[model samples]
Target: MLKIQDIRELIKAIDQSSIEEFKYEQDGTKITMRKERKMIEQVQQVVQQAPISIPQQVVTTVQPQVENIVEKEVKQETPAVKPTNLHKITSPMVGTFYSSPSPDSAPYIKVGDQVKSDSVVCIVEAMKLMNEIEAEIKGEIVEILVENGQLVEYGQELFLVKPE
Candidate 1:
C-alpha cells in the first residue's frame, strides 16, 4: 500500500534533479510524470531566486464510448439522382486499365470505333495477368472514360457505349 506522501517525495526529488520525467511504482500505486517546458523554466528561475518546491498530482482516466445505431429507426439521407446519357462499360475487377494488350500493338478500340458484341475493347492488367474486356453490346464507342496505364477501381466506368 503506497501512500500519497511517497508520491510527494518522488516529485520533490524530480524537481531537485531538474529532470523532465520521472516514474515510480510501489504495490497498488503507479505515478507517471509529464513535464512542461514553461513550468520547468519557471521552476528553475524560482529555484535559483528563492528555492521553494511545489508538487501537483493529476490522474486522468478515460473510457471509450460505443456508437449505437438502429438501422431500421435511423433516418438516412438518399443521394440526389444523376442522369446518364450513354451506356457505361464498368470494370469488373481492380486493375490497371490498358488500351492495348501489348505495348507496341495498336489500341484495341478508340472513340468513334464501331464494335460488335463480344469484341475485345480493352485489356485490364490485374495481378500480372492481362484480362481482355469485351464489349457487351454492338455499338459505337462514344467516349473513353479512363486513360491507358491508369489505376482503375472495381466497378469503375471505363467506356461509354452508344448502340448503333
Candidate 2:
C-alpha cells in the first residue's frame, strides 16, 4: 500500500513530467490520476483566435446566443431547494459510506431516529480505515442522502435532520 507521503510524491512527480495520465495498482488497491491541461489549452487557444477569424458583427450576434444557452444549462443543473430549517450532516472526507458497522448489522441511525450531538451516525471508510461519523447536532434524522457502500465526496450531504 502507498503511504500518504508516497502518494503526494507521486503526484508531484507526475506534475513535473509531461505524463498526461498515471495508474498504479498494489495488492487490492488501485489509484488513477489524469491531467486535463492539454484539453484546456486547446479550448483557450480556440477562444483566443475566434475574434481574429470572424467579423466583429457576426461575433457580436453569436456571443449572446452562446451565453444564453450556457445560462439555461446552468439553471437546469441546479438542484432542488432544501428546507431552511433542516440541518445537514455532511461527509468530512472522500470515502465509501457504510450505513451499518457490519454487513449483517442494522444501521446506526434511520429516518425519524432522534440523535444527540455525540451519537455515531455512520461510518466512512477511507484508505482502509473505518472512521465513525457523528451527528454533531441534537436532532431527528429526517433523511439519509446516501446508500450503503456508496462513494461519497467531502462536504457532500449524507443526512438531513430536524433539530429538537
Candidate 3:
C-alpha cells in the first residue's frame, strides 16, 4: 500500500522533470501517466489493479531546451532582443494532457491545426473529474509540449502558438 503523500510527492517530482511520460507499477497496483508541455492542460490519472507486477521502468524523453543553452554560448552573435511573436495557452490546473475527448475520439487539434479562441483543444482529468481546456488566443498550434496521459503542474505551458 502507498501513502497519499508519497504519491503526491512522486507527482510533483515527475512534473519538474523533462520526461514527458511515466508509469509506476507494484504487484496488484498500477498508475498511468501523461503530462503537459507549454501551458496548463488537464490530466487523467488512472490507477487500477494488475494481474502481475508491471515492471517498473522509467523512460525519459523530452524536447530539449537546447535553445536556452545555445543562447548562452552565442552571447556575441545574439541581437540582444527578445522574440515577441509567440503566444502560449496554459493549463488552469495540474492534470494530464489529452488531444481528444476520449481514447476512441479524434483529436481536436494537431501540430499544424489552426484554431480560434474558446476552442476546446484538450481534456485533462484529475481526481476522477474531466476538465476541458480551451485556446483563448487564436493561433496555430506550433508544438505539443506534452504526451498523452502524462501528469502536469499548476500553470504549466500546454501549447505553443503562433498567433494569427
lDDT of 3 by residue, 16-88 (tens): 7877888889888888655556431121111112222323341123224444644554563344553568787
Worst 10 residues of 2 by lDDT: 35-44
Clashing pairs in 2: none
**Clash count in backbone of candidate 3:** 21
Error of 1 at 136 (Å): 0.4
What is the lDDT for 80 in model 3? 51
* Per-residue lDDT value at 56 in model 2: 80
The C-alpha TM-scores of every prediction are 0.49, 0.55, 0.55
Q: lDDT, candidate 2, residue 122?
A: 98
Model 2 misplaced regions, further than 4 Å? 1-29, 32-82
Give the candidate number with the greatest lDDT: 2
Clashes of each: 0, 0, 21
In order, the Cα lDDT scores of the candidates are: 0.72, 0.84, 0.72
Q: Candidate 1: global Cα-lDDT?
A: 0.72
Q: Write the per-residue lDDT of candidate 1 for residues 1-164, one digit (tens) a residue.
A: 65545545665566567698877677766666644455544755564577433333211222121112223212232333433666788998766789997899999998999999899999887667899999998988988988778766678899988877
**TM-score, cand. 3 vs. native:** 0.55
